[model samples]
Target: MRCIIMSNELTKKAAEMLLNGATLLSEPCPYCKGVRVMKDGNALCVNCGKNLK
Candidate 1:
């Protein structure tokens, strides 16, 4: 298994999303296979550190 590390920015983003009531999704990101979250219809990739569809 491979270990993944998130940068400070990504970590902060995830925390912010959670704090703002974003829902963490079970599906993985298609680009990098990272964990995803959704908020107000926006999908964000916590591992890849970007917004998804």
Candidate 2:
């Protein structure tokens, strides 16, 4: 349902971020326990799709 759509969006965002040179972090996201990425000193949660600090 809504979660599926959200997941798709998150996947797309993660792919785009990675393609743009974002680094996939080894640590997990604190909020959703999902994979995290970093680029230009910013962190992003691939599952939550949130731009974290």
Candidate 3:
């Protein structure tokens, strides 16, 4: 029996693509624009889950 393992470089490239494909808002939420926003990790909007950069 033989098994093939993926390389770390390949895994890293895939991860980068996924992250880049995601939407990254440069401005604030229209509803709560100008309000203070914080990063909680992952792709989530600070005001309404709109995805932050």
Candidate 4:
């Protein structure tokens, strides 16, 4: 077996979000179905206040 480590900030954050069962979406939030959604962080929504992290 082999292993690869993630060191980049974006990559690390993505991996963390994935492990936490959060979907990495660059589109609008499905909950509100609006375009006013803002990125709270690497894994959270500001509009609906959904913690993707």
Candidate 5:
């Protein structure tokens, strides 16, 4: 199976955002167009519970 990996810089940025209570917004979820996405641990999604990335 192929393995997906994240670079150190990307991981660091995500951690920083989480620590500062900040969230990264890339694009809207196809299922939910709602904004104000929040970060749950390493996952990001809108208040509607849609996974953004």
Candidate 6:
């Protein structure tokens, strides 16, 4: 098996999305009030267990 490495630019973008809450678009989780939300189809919070949809 081979491993894939991410570039600095890509890593920065991902970090910005996860840290800056851009992916969540300023929407906080209702359950735990998490600021960051992953860009999944379900719009779930990463900090606590909550679904914002």
For TM-score, the strongest prediction is: 2
To one decimal, what is the Cα RMSD in angstroms of model 5 from the true structure? 9.0
lDDT of 4 by residue, 1-53 (tens): 11223124334554565676655466765676422222345434434444443
lDDT of 3 by residue, 11-42 (tens): 34435545666333456556646222333444
Cα RMSD to native, each candidate?
3.9, 1.1, 13.4, 11.0, 9.0, 8.4
Q: Tell me the TM-score of model 5.
A: 0.32
As for candidate 4, its clashing pairs are: none
Candidate 4 has a TM-score of 0.33
Task: Show pairs that collide, candidate 1.
Answer: none
TM-score of each: 0.77, 0.85, 0.29, 0.33, 0.32, 0.39
lDDT digits (tens) for residues 1-53 of candidate 1: 23244555676888898899999989998888988889998888877777876
The Cα local distance difference test for each model comes to 0.80, 0.86, 0.41, 0.45, 0.49, 0.53
> Looking at candidate 3, what is the lDDT of residue 24?
39
For residues 1-53, what per-residue lDDT tens digits would candidate 5 score against the true structure? 11123334345555665677877566665565534334664444433443443
lDDT of 2 by residue, 1-53 (tens): 98889988888888888999999999899888899888888888878877887
lDDT agreement of model 3 with the native: 0.41
Which ranges of candidate 1 are over 4 A from the true structure? 1-6
Q: Name the lDDT value of residue 19 in candidate 2.
A: 95
Error of 1 at 34 (Å): 0.6
**Model 5 accuracy (lDDT, Cα):** 0.49
Worst 10 residues of 2 by lDDT: 44-53
Better of 2 and 4 by lDDT: 2
Could you arrange the candidates by TM-score from highest to lowest? 2, 1, 6, 4, 5, 3
Which candidate order results from sorting by lDDT in descending order? 2, 1, 6, 5, 4, 3
